[model samples]
Structure formats: structure tokens, C-alpha cells
Target chain A: MATHGKKQDNRSPADWWLFVLGFVLFAAVGFWATPAILYAEKPQPFQFSHKLHMEQVGEGCQSCHAFREDGSYTGIPSLEKCKECHGEEPMGETPEEKVFSKDYVAKNKPIPWQVYSKQPPCVFFSHAAHVANAGLECASCHGDHGDTEKLRTYEYNRLTGYSRDIWGWSLIPLDGPPKRMKMDDCAKCHRDNGVRDACFVCHK
Target chain B: MSSSASEMRFGMVIDVDKCTGCGACSVACMSENNVGVLPDETDKIRSITWLRVYQIDNGQPYPNTQIAFFPRPCQHCAGSQGHHTPCVSVCPATATDRDPKTGIVSQIPTRCIGCRYCVAACPYHARYFNWYDVPWPEGMDKPLSPFVAPRMRGVVEKCTFCFHRYQRAQNKAFTSGEAMGEMDYQTACTEACPSGAITFGDLNNPEHKVHELKKSPYAFRLLERLHTDTAVYYVSAREWVRRQADNYLSGEKLAKVQAGGGH
Candidate 1:
């Protein structure tokens, strides 16, 4: 009823029920939006300055992850590969290096550095296609790891094996358009670029 | 000037009649291809043997028994009148390709991710996988042929029809401006045989030894009904040794093959 016409005084019971339903929907979304922690995401073991490594140190990604002659990639540097440069312990001259050497590599045990960039074999993620072909920057998927000295830990859901903050999109990327890697985002990119997008090409 | 344009199909002829099952072919093939050995070769099922020499029993008693050694390799089939050979059709990567020029099946290990699909597809059991990283005692790597690349930990490898020899032949042909004639590329097993039991050349090439040998009265292919159109053909004067090549339902397959090579 219009107020200018002055037709009706009381609203219907159905309108009140509808109001309740809308309120309930809103509350449920807010609740789901709350951050759910997976594995207690923590800072990396030690602060690694990629800026010092890349721009100042003049080292590249291939320095750590070596490529095979057959075009397949293998991450993680071998102990012997590292000893080639640091045999006399040149890098370990610093306090941080001393700590890394004393705790991790001195005893022949390799560092179990956690990598967020790694994906499962079931999901085919090729750095070659993305970086070499599409001309995408490293910062696109990795976010801003170069700027930051220390790696931060976020809670990861064990069952799903994804970060809890990303799962709900509350703690991380709260203000961004769509948080977490969704299939639709990939589909949109593929559709824009006129690629075959065959299931076996990526999925298999 | 046009050497093999008359007829060209690369093939092999094995004389089981002369074969003593001496296992020289197996040793020669392994040494030539750089096939690795396992400590536990006791389990022949899982072990990698590109050329497995089977010792067939005649099932006779009272000194009437006979035995023969049959050395098998990658069939390099032309298919049934050029249909689908089992291993070639199933490979997803398109790594292996049948040479249209020579009719030889080639193995591309660099492309193989050790999926092991081709391993199961072969009924003759030709393909092998590198389960462990290849290791040499101390000084053996230098002796390996530079033409044959040592395979890494993860991949499938098979007989290459001694492709290095073909490359050498082609190199010679290119330099001399002469064609790569038949018998120019022979397998190591063929050359290593003391009794000259093995013949290697193109089956399609009429001038080649293999082509003429394939038309022999006793010439027959392994698993002909399966229709691999295998480049490797066997000649046996005996009936029972011929029967051992493939599975037959009574007189069905034998009758067909016998009719042709029977004379």
C-alpha cells in the first residue's frame, strides 16, 4: 500500500515470514564466511629474502629447481649441487647461514622446505605453459612472496587439503572479487584465450 | 639410382631349424641395447628382457623329446594387411611411430613417462620398464655406444631395429649420393649369430634377402591371427616347432598359415 494513497495500516503475516527468511539467509552466509582453520598455518622455519637472492644475489628460479634434458621439471636442489658453490661454506658466513647450516644441512640432512606452489599429480599444473607460453608473471599465483622476508602460515583444512582462510575467503582475500582457486576462474581464462581446453590435456 | 623403390618393407627371418637355443641372440641384444639387469632376475615375470629366448619342450619321453630356443624381439608389425598393431595404437603420447620408409617400429623413451600401458599391451612381452636408476660398477659407462642413450629412471624402452646402424647407413648414403640399399641395416643379434640363423633386411624390398626369405616354403609369422604383420618371420621345416609360435584353436590358424607356406 502507498503512503500517499493511505490505503493500508497493517502489513501481512506472510511479509513478516519473508522478512524472517531473509534474515536467516543473511545470518547463515555470515556464519559460513567466518574463517575455518586447517593446519595451523605458521611462519616458515627461517626468513628467506628473495629480494636479496634475486635482484642483489643475481640468482634465478632454475638455481633451485633444475630442468631435465627431456623437458620435465624437478624441484629441490641436491646436497652435492649446493656444495659446489658453498663447499668452503661461503653462504654460511652470515649468522642466518650459520643457523641454517648448523640446524639443517651440516649433518647431511636436507631442508624440508614447505612449498605452497606445489600441486598434486592428479591436477596437471605446468609452469612452462603459464610462464613461457602465456607470459604470466611469477607473482600472479604466488602472490607477493618476493616482497615478504618471512613465509606466513595459514590454517589448512586436512580433509580438503587447502588453506582454511582461502576455503571461506574471510581471513585471506576478503575484499577481492572471488577468493581461492575456483574452476570457473580457470574456465573463464581458457574461454577468453581460444584454447582447446581438452579434459585429457590438463586433468589426465 | 633408385635402390629400394622396386619394393621396400624392413623385416627379419629367423631359422628355428638351425637355432640351438644357445642364447647368443639374447646376450647380443642386451649388450647392444644397454638393457639393465636386476639382482633378482629369478622372477622372469617382472624382469626386463627385450630378447627372451624361450626353451620349448617337445613333451616326449624315452629319449624321443626335442627342445628349441626361440629369441623374440619387438615385432615391428605392419598390422593385419596394415590394420592396428596392439602396442602402436594404444600409446597415448604418439611417442612410437612406424617408419613408412622402412616399416620398422621405433621406441621414443624420452617421450615415455613410464605409464607402462604399452608394457601390458604387448602379448609377446617385448617392452621393459626402468624400475631403478641404471648403475654401473665403476668403469663400464665408457664402453656404451654413444648412439644409444642410457635411459633414466622413469621410462619404457624397446628394441630399436639397431637404428644407429640405419643412421650410419643413411649418413653413408647421403655422403656418397647412393641409396641405403637393403641389408644395409642389420640387428646386432643377426650379426652375432655364429650359425647364421638370423636374416635381417626389408620384407617389402624384393632385392633384399629378408623379402625373398619371407616367401620361403616354411616361412611363417608369430601370432599371425593376432595379425601383427610382424617384420620378424620364422622358417621351420618341422610341424611341432611351427605350432609353438602362436595359440591355435585345433586346425583353424595353422590351416590358413599352412596353406600359404606349406609348399
Candidate 2:
């Protein structure tokens, strides 16, 4: 019994140091390095200032993001819509406009805008209900993405490879707008508005 | 054909006599729901079709034999009274559900854990498991219906009766200040049926066509003796077709007349 106890407790001070060091290293890697590796920043197709366009157009978000008579949301304006104003030449003298005209508009190619607010394949979010029926402003869930001067580098989760909008911006999600786009966020909003529904209500 | 109430039980009544064995309904359903078919889909069991046409025949020799096409969609079984649908009750993840209000069985692919318990529990063989990610051909994704999100691999999917169409109809009615009726909301399969074999409407509403059709003497459900209480009904004039609906005892008499006399 004594020999067994001795063998069991035979870890030295150096061994103890190594064990503690290994544990700390594992913890640090798990808490920080792993998350750092998992998230990546991707560039958008072109930077179009929503604030500038909103101010110039004076028609609100609907001018760009149209809602059809059938209550279907036409997401991300087509190049034809862009050509309405930028028909002859590029609208503005900015690099973005030059790229839009020379690379896309002049060539008659559609801008492949990387959708930031794109949910997962399973979620079914109806823009008509949130926009027309519920009367929510563009700033509600999207935060101030529309007002920014430049588009933020889209952060993607390497595991799911989904836009951060699906999981949220922070490593540790907190309570607030734009913190996360998980089901809980939707449920919270629905609960606040006294909307109770089954799981299939938003998921499909 | 008024605005649908919570008590509304939307169901389908397909006239087996009218179906011409054409696969229009299945094709339409696949495209409408973005149900992708694999390249090597020769294995009918592995292939996923929200609405599949099964060719069943009367087990007889030569000239006496006749085959009929049975278009099988998810029955959206009401089950006994209202709850305990075979698929719904056996689902470990609760991915599939029978909506208490509309009686439409809804399958949420996102919530599905791919356990496939619902697939096994379903007697109709309506549920299909996605063996691979949606194999959309080049540029085919562009034309995919924006309303229905394409499902990923490792999930189970089944018919939702085009519930999104109902949602759109409701939205249109709300916008136009009108009441959405049965005519405004129809499944893609129902609309695409060339023979008009499939009829869909609120079964609870007496004014609806399905309410009248389901009460026909010829109308019978598949495996009704087990009492799945499936919402989908089939009507046929043939006695053999009705006999083929469910199993019977060795000497059990199903109908008053024997099998060979139908015209």
C-alpha cells in the first residue's frame, strides 16, 4: 500500500511545473488562439456608402431594397437599378464608382455583393412581415451598417464558414442589437412583442 | 374560401382514377421546393421526392393485370384525434410537427439532427433523408426559388404542402385589404397536375371541395385500419385498387364484391 501510494504521489516539483504549464498552455490556446484561427476577414465586392446614397436619393431603404407588390423583398439592387443614375458615366469620382462603372457597369456585370446579414440555410426570415407589417426600420437588426462610410471587413466563422451575422460579432455574445443573429435573438424580439409561435415559425 | 381560421385543416384529395402516371407533380414539387436530385438517382429508395408517384398493380397474370399511378405526398396525418402523428411523435429532435392550427405537418430542416427516427416511424414513407448536399448543377442555383431555402446534407425533409404559398397569399391579402381564400393558396403540385388529379383546400370548411370529396363512398385512405388518420385521401372506382389500400386477413372479405368484376 505504501509503495503504491509512493508511486502514485511520485510527481516532482519540475513535473508539477510541467503539468501546470501544459494545462495553462491548453487553456490559453482554447480560450484565445483557437478562436483567432477560426475567424477570418473577407473583403466586399465594392464599397458603396449607404449614407451617401440615402442622403442623395432621399427615398429611404426602399429605394435601393425594393418590396414587390407580392410582398416579396428584392434584396441587393441589380446593376440595372444602378444604371438608372449611372447610365452615361460613373456617378461619383470615387474609386468605388470607377470600379463599379469600369469593371461592372461598363461590362454589364452584376455586383456580387457579399451579403452580411445572410442567415443560415435553415432560417426563413420574411422581410415583408418585419418591414411592412411590423413597421421596423432598417436600423433595427442591421444596426448602423447602412450609415457607415466604408463597409467593415466581413468576419466569417471558419467552422461553419457563415457570416458573423449568423453567430454575431463578439467572441462572447452580449445582450443588444447586432450582438448575435441566433434563434434566441429572434425569440427575444418576438417575446418582447408578445409573439408566441412553434419552432417552425421561423425555422424551415 | 374566406380567410383561413385556426380551426382550418388543410388537406389533399387526389383522384387516383384521373392520374395519368405523368410525373409533372413530382417535377413541379422538386423545382418549387428546391429539392435537388443526385446525379446517380437510380436508387429510388435513396432519391428524394416530396411528391413521388408509385406504380402499383393488381397482382394478376396477363390481360387481367392493370396498373395505377399513386402520387404520394406527406399525408400530414392528424393522427387519432390531433396529436401523436407517427412521424411527429417519434421524431427525437422535434424537427417535424403537426401545426395545431392549420393541421399542416411542417418539417424544419435546420432543427433536424438527421437522426431519421421520423423516417422510420412514418408508414407512408414520405420522409426522405438528404444523403448529400443539394447538388445544384452549374447556374441552376440562380433559378432556385428564393422562398424556400435549399436543405443541406445530413437532414430529413418532407412535404410542407407549400406553406410558403399560403404565407404569401396572406401577405398579399393583407396588403390589398382583402381576405385570402382557398383559391389564393394552392400547392405547386396541385397547380401543376395536368389531369387535375390533386385537389387541396381546408378540409374542416364544409364549403371546400375536399370536404365533399373525402366523404365519397369510394374514398379510402392507405392503411386506414392502423388509424393513422392521414389527411390525404384517394378516390377510385375500382374494387381491386381499394383492396390494395390496406392489408387484410387470409380469408377476410374487404368489399361486398370479389376482385375481378370491375370494368
Candidate 3:
């Protein structure tokens, strides 16, 4: 019985290290969790009226970002893609139509169109990889932009090419199932979702 | 393509004794890979070549002068059981990979955003960057091999060991429902060399001629001590030509290796 007590007391140093690691993980969750929870889940930039665009005009996401033959996707509609359809002033009624024809089409520049969900460069955020592989909704990462009624005005960090809000905070829960689009955020999702990768597999 | 580790150290062995300095292999590699040509390709570094023949000469004047041409390409290291390969270790993007199946180092050009770290990591300088976009004179894009896409400007390119051929061969096997056979793949340079200097086959297969040639007494890898585990081996009777491929420090361990090991 005395020997059994001694054996019970003699836990391996590995056990101690694992305990320390668990405590560290808990602390990290606590520290990071607070900021993410508190941030305002502000409405998206530009009042992008998706119902007006998708429902009334009968356009799809592909109407903007053209699909490639090889299953890759390309840029949102360039000024030319818009000009191809919208004429030099005909059947225009709403303020939105005026903004599209007069401001964007009249000027030869592609709409300094702010891409709402611009994932950073170091990561390969293949919409194909996720959509085809995991069966995830677009709203899973990009918040409910499709439901909104106005153009989402883009907020920028500029230097990092990250959204100003994403650089700091989001109402998205960091502790729950992966909600954000950081590399580690995606890595966590991959781990939970049974997708695996090396650092180079996604980093570059 | 994969087999047990003992039977799967994929490699290449080059016979320098049989080689002539004709640039046939280089020309074939460029055309086969669809490597873009700049109007100013006179500069070699900025130029793309999957197989490049380098001229090496015994630095003696007149009658004593001896010249041999050596071709440089990716070594495709076996990588120390599971450790560092010069290019494979440092790649920030998983653009390059040593296939465990065949031991071929595969390059994914689309994944490579011209980070040139792999270019600099290779001791042989095999990888090339597309500085200028591929400009096919009007109405010539259809002639391109449907298997290989011509690379755009700003991507790193290299010898795929003619992986498109391997893929086609694999596809044929898949449709026929037969296993991929030994003679299934041969790099364009190997077939194009007039002198038959380059031999391409899976080193892992004992029945393959490449496997037997690998055991020759004359066979040696480039920079073996740097531990790159280079697949390419050169067999040269000329000591100067063999020595020119890699640098040896003054009275270094390789001097001892040559004295004691009899390689």
C-alpha cells in the first residue's frame, strides 16, 4: 500500500509539462477571448443592396467574379464587364442605377471596387478548396453580405491590406468553432474539420 | 510510384564519358516545357533552361587544353531520410515537393509567385524565373502541347522531369486498367540528346537500366558532402571535369574521402 502511494506520487515530468501546457492554452483562450467578444459587429462597408442586385437584376456571384474553365475564379466585374451590359443611359430609374452608370461606367476606371472579403496573400484561401471540399456556406466566413440592401463601404488597414476591423477585433467568437479568416483561424477550422496541412502547404 | 524505402531511393546517373557538348538537350528542354524566351535572352541568368549544358575546360593554354561540357539541372535530393533538402527545406510556399511515390521533385508553377528562394537554394541553379511573358507570334498558341500551359511573367519554372509525359502515361494506364510500367516516363532531354548522354528512368526499379548504372564504380553525385542527396550522378574519367562540378576546400575531408574511399 505504501509502495502504491509512492507510485501514485511519482508522476512523470511529461505529465507536469502537459498540465502546464493545458493551463497555458486556457490562459490564452481567456486573454484572446475577451477582445473578440466585446468588439462591435458593425455593418459591412458600402450599403451593397444585394437583394436589388441579385433578385431584381437576376445576377449571380459569377456575374461579378467570372469562373475559369480550370475551376479557378477571377476578379470581380471590371468596368468593362459592367459596360458590356449597362448602356450609355437607358431605362435607368433608381439612385443605384445612376451611381452604376454615371460614376462607374462613365469613368473608364474599374470600380475602385472594394473587395469585401479580401483574404491576405500568404494564405491560399481557395474558395474552390473550401466550397468543393468542406461544403461550407460563403456566409460561414464572409458575414451576411448577401442579405444586405446597400453597397458595403470598405474599411482598410491599408498598410497590411487587411480590413481595419479584422486587424483589431470582430464580434466573431475566437473561442468557439473557427469564425474568422486568419491563418491560424483557418488552421483551427482545418483541424476541427479533418483537413490537414503543413505550414508551407498554406502559408505560401 | 512508391515502394519500400530500401527500393525507393530515386536517383539519376549521368555518363560524362559518353557526353558531347552539343546543346541539343537544352534546346529540347526549353521547347518542351514552353519556357518563355525574352528578346534579351543573351544574359544567361535571366534566361530559362530546364537543362543547361555548362562548358568546363582544363585551364591550360594551347595543346594542353581539354574541354568537357556538363549539364546542370535540379538534383532532386533524397533529403537525409527526413530532414533538410537545400531547396525543399527553405521553400515558404509548398510550390516544390519531393514525391515519396517516385522521389521526383515536382514544381508547381502556379503556386510559385516568383519567390526565387528555390532558385537561389539550388546549388546547380536549375530553377528559372519567367521575367517576360510568353509571347507566341500571332496564331501560334494552338501548337503548344495541350498538356503543358505556357507560364506567364512572374513565376518560377523548372524541369518537371517531363511530368506531363508521366501524367499522360499514367492516364493511359488508368484507362487500360493496367499498372504503370517501368518504361512509362522519359524526360525530353534524355530522348533528344543525339549522343544518348542523359538516361531517364525510375532509379527505384532494379530492372530499370538506371538502377544498374547507379551502381557503377565511376558514378558520383554533385556536392554529396553538403548532404543534398542529389539524384543526378556524373561519371567522368577526367579528374578535372569531375572536380569542376563542386568546390572542395583546401585539403578538406573530400581529399581524405578520395584517398581512403577509392570512389
Using DockQ, give the best candidate's number: 2
lDDT of each: 0.66, 0.82, 0.65
Candidate 2, B103-162: lDDT as tens digits: 889998878899999999998999999998767888989988877889889999999999
RMSD for each model, in Å, please? 12.8, 4.5, 13.1
lDDT of 3 by residue, A1-204 (tens): 355646756788999999999999999998887555543333432234666667645556556655444434464666677676677583457765776667666766566656646655434445544554345676677666666777544555534556543444444556322234555666767898765643333432
Scored by Cα lDDT, where does model 2 land?
0.82
**What residue runs in model 3 are displaced by over 4 Å at the alpha carbon?**
A1-204, B1-10, B250-255, B258-263
Model 2 chain A weakest 10-residue run by lDDT: A168-177
lDDT: worst 10-residue window of model 3 chain A: A38-47
Q: Name the lDDT value of residue A180 in candidate 1.
A: 47
Q: Choose 1 or 2, whichever is better by lDDT.
A: 2
Per-residue alpha-carbon lDDT of candidate 1 for residues B1-263, written as tens digits (9 for 90 to 100): 23336535666789988888888888888788777666677868767777777888777885899887787878877677567767777889975667665676766776677888888888788888888777766787767765566676778888777776665555455444566666667888888888898899877666777767778878877887676767788888877888888787765756565524411
Say which docking band candidate 2 falls in. Answer: acceptable
Question: TM-score of chain A for each candidate?
Answer: 0.65, 0.86, 0.64
Predicted structure with the largest lDDT when compared to the true one: 2
* Residue-level lDDT tens digits of model 3 in B125-217: 888888887678877665666456677688887776776666555544433446566666677888888887778777767777777777765
TM-score per model over all chains: 0.55, 0.85, 0.55
